[model samples]
Target: MIRVERVGPLATIQDLGRPGWFDSGVGIAGAADRSSLRLANRLVGNPEGAAGIEALLGGLELLAQRHLTVAVTGAPAPASVDGRPVGAASVLEIEEGQRLRLGLATTGLRSYVAVRGGIDVAPVLGSRSRDTLSGIGPEPLRAGDVLPVGPPPRTHPIVDVAPVAAPAGDLLTVRVVPGPRADWFADAGALYRGEWTVSSDTDRIGARLDRRSGPTLDRRGAGELPTEGMALGSIQVPPSGQPVVFLADHPITGGYPVVAVVVDADVDLVAQARPGQPMRFRPC
Candidate 1:
C-alpha cells in the first residue's frame, strides 16, 4: 500500500478512461496528458494503460509501506526520495517507510507517477479515472488515503530513463480541423487568427482560451443548438465569443456551438499548457 501524505493543487488516480459510455452520458475522464501517463507506466514496467497518479502542478507526496518501484513523468517536476534528489523520468526504488516527494512543477500543468504494479483502486464504469465534471470513479486523492498496488505483471522493467522534453515555455501551437458546426460561426477563421492565452479557469473539464489577438468569434446562426454529444478536443464557442477546448473530463454533451476541433495529437499539448501560457491554432 502507498500512503498519500500530501496532494498539492490536485491529484487523482487515472487509467486510459472508459470509452463507449457517451451514449449513457459518461465522458472518458482519464489523465489529461495521456502520453506522459503512458511513459510513466512504461518506465515502471506496467502496461501502458495501467492506472497511476495524475498530480496537478506537482506537490504530491507518498510513502512506501513496503518495497516498491515507481516512476514520475510529465511537468518535469523535481523529485526527491527521503530528501535525496531523484530523476523524474527514471525508475526509482522506495523501501519500506521511505517517502517520495515532488515539488511544484516549473513547466506544464500535470505530472504522472506510476508504480511497478498499477494502482489497484476500485474502478467505476471500468476505469479508475476521476471525472471532475461528472463525479465518477474514485474521488480526488486526499491526504491519508492508502492506495493498493496491483500484482506485478510478468515482465520486468527494461527502461531506466526516458528523456522527454519538458513542456514548452513559450507559445505552443496545435493543429485543428474544422468542427461539425463550423458554419455556425460568422468567421470560422477567428480561432486561428489569434495567439490565445489559457484562462485561469482551465481544468480537466476543458481549457478556456482568451484571445491575445484577432477578431472575436461571432455566431451567424443565432438560435440555440439542441444539446449534442461533445467530443474531447472540440473547440466549443459559447456566447462570450471565447473558444474552449474540451479536455478529459468534459461533459458528454453540450448545447454550445463547436467551431473547431483540435487534432488528437495536439490535445495532449493542450493538456500540458498552464494558465497564461500562449497558444496558437493552425488549421490542418
Candidate 2:
C-alpha cells in the first residue's frame, strides 16, 4: 500500500481507458501520454493496462506502507527516496515506510509512476481511468489518499533500464490527416503552413492552438451543424478560428468542424506539449 503524502497540481489513477463506451457518451479517458504508462508498467513487470498514477507537472510525494518495487516514466523529472536521488525509467525497490518524492518536471508535462503490483483501485465501467470531462471512475489524487497495490506478477521485469523520449526543442512538427469535415473549411492547406503556438488553456479535453500571424480558417458550412462523433486527435476548429486538438478526455461528440486529425504516431507529442510551445502540422 502507498499513501499520498502530498498531492501535486494534478494526479490521478489511470489505466488503458474504457474503450467501446462511446455509445454511452463516455469518452476514453486515459493517460495523456499512454506510451509512458506502458513503459512504466513494463519496467515493473505489470500488465500494459495496469492502473498507475499520472502526475501532471510532477511534485508528487508518497509514503510506502510495504516493501515494493516501483518505476517512474514519462516527463524527465527528479525522483528521490528519502532525499537520495533515484533514476527514472528504471525499477527501484522501496522499503516499508520509505518516502518517494517526484519533483517538478524538467521537460515534458506529465509523468507516470507504476508500482510492481499495479494500483489496485476499483474499476468503473471496465476501466480505472478518471474521466475528468464526464466525471466517471475514480477521483483525482489528494493528500492522505491510500492506494492499494495488487499482488505481483510471476514474470520478472525484463529490462534493467528503459529509455523514453521527453518532449524537447522549441518546435514540434506533428502529422495531420484531413478530417471528414475538411471540406467545411475554405483553406485546409493553411494548417500545414502555419506555425501555431499551444495555448495556456490546454487540458485533458483538448490542446488549443493559437493562430499566431496565420490566416484564420473561414467556415463554408453553417454554424448550427448537427453534432457528430468526435475522435481522439481530431483538430476541431471553433468559431474563433483557432484549432483545438482533442485529447483522451475530449467529448464523444462535437458540433465544431474538424479540419484535420493528428496522426496516431504524433498524438503523444500533443500530450507533452507545454503552453506557448510552437508546432506545425504536416499533412501526409
Candidate 3:
C-alpha cells in the first residue's frame, strides 16, 4: 500500500480508460498522456492497462507502506526517493516507509507514475479512470490518501528505462480532419489552416480557442440541436463561432456542430496545452 502525504493541485488514478461504454452513457476517462502511461506501466512490468496515478502540473509526495518497484514517466519531472535522486524515466526500488517526491515539471502538463502490480481500486464501469466532466470513477486524490497495491503477477519481467522525449514547447501543432459539419461555414476549411490560441478555459472536457479573422460561419437557421455523441477528437463550434476541441473527459454528447476532429495521434498534444499558447491546426 502507498499513502499520499501530499497531493499536488490535481491528481487522479487512471488506466487506458473505459472503452465501449459510450452506448451506456459512460465517458472514456483515463490518463491524458496515454502513450506515457502505457510506457510507464511497461517499465514496471505492470499490465499495460493497469491503473496508475496521473499528476497534473506536478508536485506529488507519496510514502510506500511496503517495498515496491515503481516507475515515473511523462512530462519529465525531477523524481526523488528517500531523499536520493532517481532517474525520471527509469524504475526504482522503493523500500517500506520510503518517501517519493516529484517536483514541478519543466515541460508538459501531466506526468504518470506507475507501480509494479498497479494500484488496486474498485473499478467503475470497467474502468478506474476518473471522469472530471461526469463525476464518474474515483474522486481526485487528496492529502493522506492511501492506495492499495494489487497482488503482483506471478511472472517477473525485465523492462527498459530509456527516457521519453519531451515536447518542444507550449505551442503545439495539431493535425485535424474535416468534421461532419464542415459545410456549415462559408470557408470552414480555412479555419484549420489558420493559427489560433488555446483559451484559459481549456480542461479535460474541451479546449476553447481564440478565433482568428477568417471565413464567417452561417449562423442563420443553424440553431443548436439536441446533444449527440461526441468523439474524442471532435472540434465543436458554438454559436459564438469559437472552436472547442474535445478531450478525453469531454461530455458524452454536445449540441454544437463539429467543424473538425483532431487526429488521434495529436490528441495527446491537446492534453498538454496551457492557456495562451499558440496552436495551429493542419489537415491530416
In model 1, the Cα lDDT at residue 172 comes to 98
**lDDT accuracy of residue 51 in candidate 1:** 98
TM-score per prediction, in order, is 0.98, 0.97, 0.93
- Top candidate (TM-score): 1
Order candidates by lDDT, high to low.
Answer: 1, 2, 3
Clash tally for model 1:
0
Superior by TM-score: candidate 1 or candidate 2? 1
lDDT preference between candidates 2 and 3, better one = 2
lDDT of 2 by residue, 161-266 (tens): 8876667758889999986888888887778876999999998899999976567677776655699999899999988888999998999999988989998888
Task: Between candidates 1 and 3, name the one with more favorable TM-score.
Answer: 1
lDDT of each: 0.92, 0.90, 0.84
Which pairs clash in the backbone of model 3?
A: none
Q: On a 0 to 1 TM-score scale, where does candidate 1 land against the true structure?
A: 0.98
Best by lDDT: 1
Candidate 3 lDDT, 1-284, residue by residue in tens: 99999877699999989988888888887888788898888888888999999998779999999998898988877899988998877988899999999998877778899998999999998999999988999989999888999998765557557656785465578988886877666677767665788888887788898855445444446566677888998988888877888888988888888888998888888887777778888876
Better of 1 and 3 by lDDT: 1
List model 1 lDDT by residue over 1-284, tens digit each: 99999999999999999997887888889999999999999888899999999999999999999999999999988999999999879999899999999999999999999998899998898998899888989989999999999998989888789888999999999999987898998888888887999999899999999989888889996689999988889999999887899999999899999988899998989999999999998998
Worst 10 residues of 3 by lDDT: 211-220
